[model samples]
Target: MDPAVTAAALDDEHRTFARLLREHQGIVATVAASYCRDPHDRADLAQEIAAQLWRAWPNYDPARRFSTWMYRIALNVAISAVRSAALRQRHAVPFDERLHDVADPAPRDPQAEQQIRALHAFIQAQAPLDRALLLLYLDDRSHREMAEILGLSETNIATKISRLRQRIRHEL
Candidate 1:
C-alpha cells in the first residue's frame, strides 16, 4: 500500500474503533473492577485495557464481533494487571471510603447493590481463572464465547461454569 493510502486507512480504522470503543467501553471498567480493588487502580486498569486494545486494533478480525474481540483484550489486560503486585502498586490508589461504583445501568437499588457487593467480595477470593470465568458468566457470555475467549473447549467451559456456579451457591 502507498504511504498516503496507508495513512488514510489507518485514520478510517481509528475512527471506527473509537466509535466501537464508546459503545462497549463498559467492558474495560467491568473487567478492571473485577480485578482491581482500589478505585484509582481500577481506572488505571481501564486505561491500560484501552491502550492495549488500540495497539491490537489493526490485527482485529472483522469477521468476529467487535465486542468479543474487545472483551478478550480487556480480560487479558485485567489478568496481566492482577498478576503483578508491583505493577498494580505502580498505579496504586489510596483506598476510597465511598462505595465502588459499578458500571451497571439498571435502576439503583440499595438492597441489590449490597448483594452485588457481597458477590464481588466472594469473587475476589477466587483463583484467577475462576475469577475470569465467573466474570464472563456474570456478563452473560455464551458458553461458546467464553470458551473462545478463554481458549478452552466448549465442554470445558460448561463444566467450569457449572462448578463455579455450584461453588458460588455453596459459599454465598
Candidate 2:
C-alpha cells in the first residue's frame, strides 16, 4: 500500500493496456471503417473505441483472449456510433454530393474493384447487428467466437450466417 508501489503498479497496468491495444489496433480501424464513411468520423470512432477499451481495461480478464475482448468493445462502440449518427440524421437535411470523398481514378483491376465496392455497399446496407455479423464472418471468426463477441448463441450465429450468405448471393 506504499505510494511508490502503487505508482509502479499503475505504470505497469498502463504499459500492459498500451501493448494490448497496439497488438489489436486493426480491430478498431476495421470496425470504424465498416461503420463510418467519412475519414474524420472513422478516426473519431476509432478514438472512442480505444478510450472505451482503456476505461474497461481493469475489468478485462487475462484468461480471456485479448482479440476477442477487443472485438467486442470495438464493435460495440462502432455500432453505437452508427446508431447515434442515424438518430442525428433523422431530423437533419441532406448534404451536398460535392462534399463526399472522391474515388481513385485508376483501379488496378476494375472488376475486382467493382466487386469490392459492391460488397462494401451490401455490408453498409445491412442493419447494425447484421453488419457486425458480416464483419466478423468476413474476418474469418468461428461461429462460437462470433457468438461470444456478439453475445448470441452459436446456433443463432450459424443460422444468421447462412441467411446472410443467401442474401449476399441474391443481392450482390
Candidate 3:
C-alpha cells in the first residue's frame, strides 16, 4: 500500500477511537468512581482506563457495542487497581463521606438520602467481583452483557445476581 494510504487509514482509525471514547467516557468515570473513593485515585484510575482502552483499540471488534467493550476494559483496569492497592496497603481504606454528599437541586428526601448512603457503604464493603456485579446490575445491564463483560456464563451471572440481591436484602 502507498504510504499516504497507510497514513489515511491510521488517521481514520484514530478518529474512530476518539469518537467512541468521547461517546462512552462516562463508563470510565463510573468505573473509576465505583472503585476508588478518593478523587485523586478516581482521576488516576480514569486515566489508566483511557490509556488501556487506547492500547487495546487495535483488538476491538467493530461488530460489538463500543460501550460493552469499554466497560469490560474499564472494569478490568479498575479491578486490577483495587487489587494492587489492597496488596500494597494490606488494609481496608476508610469510607469516603464525600459519596454521601449529593448536590441535588430538587428537594432532598432525608430518608432516601440515608438509604442511598447505606447502599454506597454496602457496595464499598463488597469484594471487587461482587462490587462489579452490583454496578452492572444497578446500571440495568442484561445478564448476557454482564456475562460477556465479566467473562462468566449467563447462568452464573444470573445466579450471582440473585445471590447478591439476597445478600443486600439480608444485610441492608
Give the top-scoring candidate (lDDT): 3
Candidate 3's error at 58, in angstroms? Answer: 0.6
Once fitted onto the true fold, the runs of candidate 1 whose alpha carbons sit more than 4 angstroms away are 1-3, 88-102, 105-111
Candidate 2 positional error at 62, Å: 1.0
Each candidate's TM vs. the true structure?
0.84, 0.86, 0.88
Error of 1 at 14 (Å): 1.0
The lDDT for every candidate, in the order shown, is 0.78, 0.79, 0.82
Q: Best-fitting candidate, measured by TM-score? A: 3
lDDT of 1 by residue, 24-48 (tens): 9777767776777666677888899
Task: Report the C-alpha lDDT of model 2 over 1-172, residue by residue, as the tens digit.
Answer: 8999999999999999999898878678778777766666667878999999999999999999999999998988877776785634632211112222232344357787677668777887788899899889988999989999999999999999999999989998
Model 1, position 40, has a per-residue lDDT of: 69
Q: What is the C-alpha lDDT profile of model 3 across 1-172, one tens digit per residue? A: 8999999999999999999899888678777778876677778888999999999999999899888889999999988987894533643422344533532345558998687778888888888888888888988999999999999999999999999899889988
| lDDT of residue 168 for candidate 3 | 86
Q: What count of clashes does model 2 give? A: 0
Rank the models by TM-score, top first. Answer: 3, 2, 1
Reference-based TM-score, model 2:
0.86
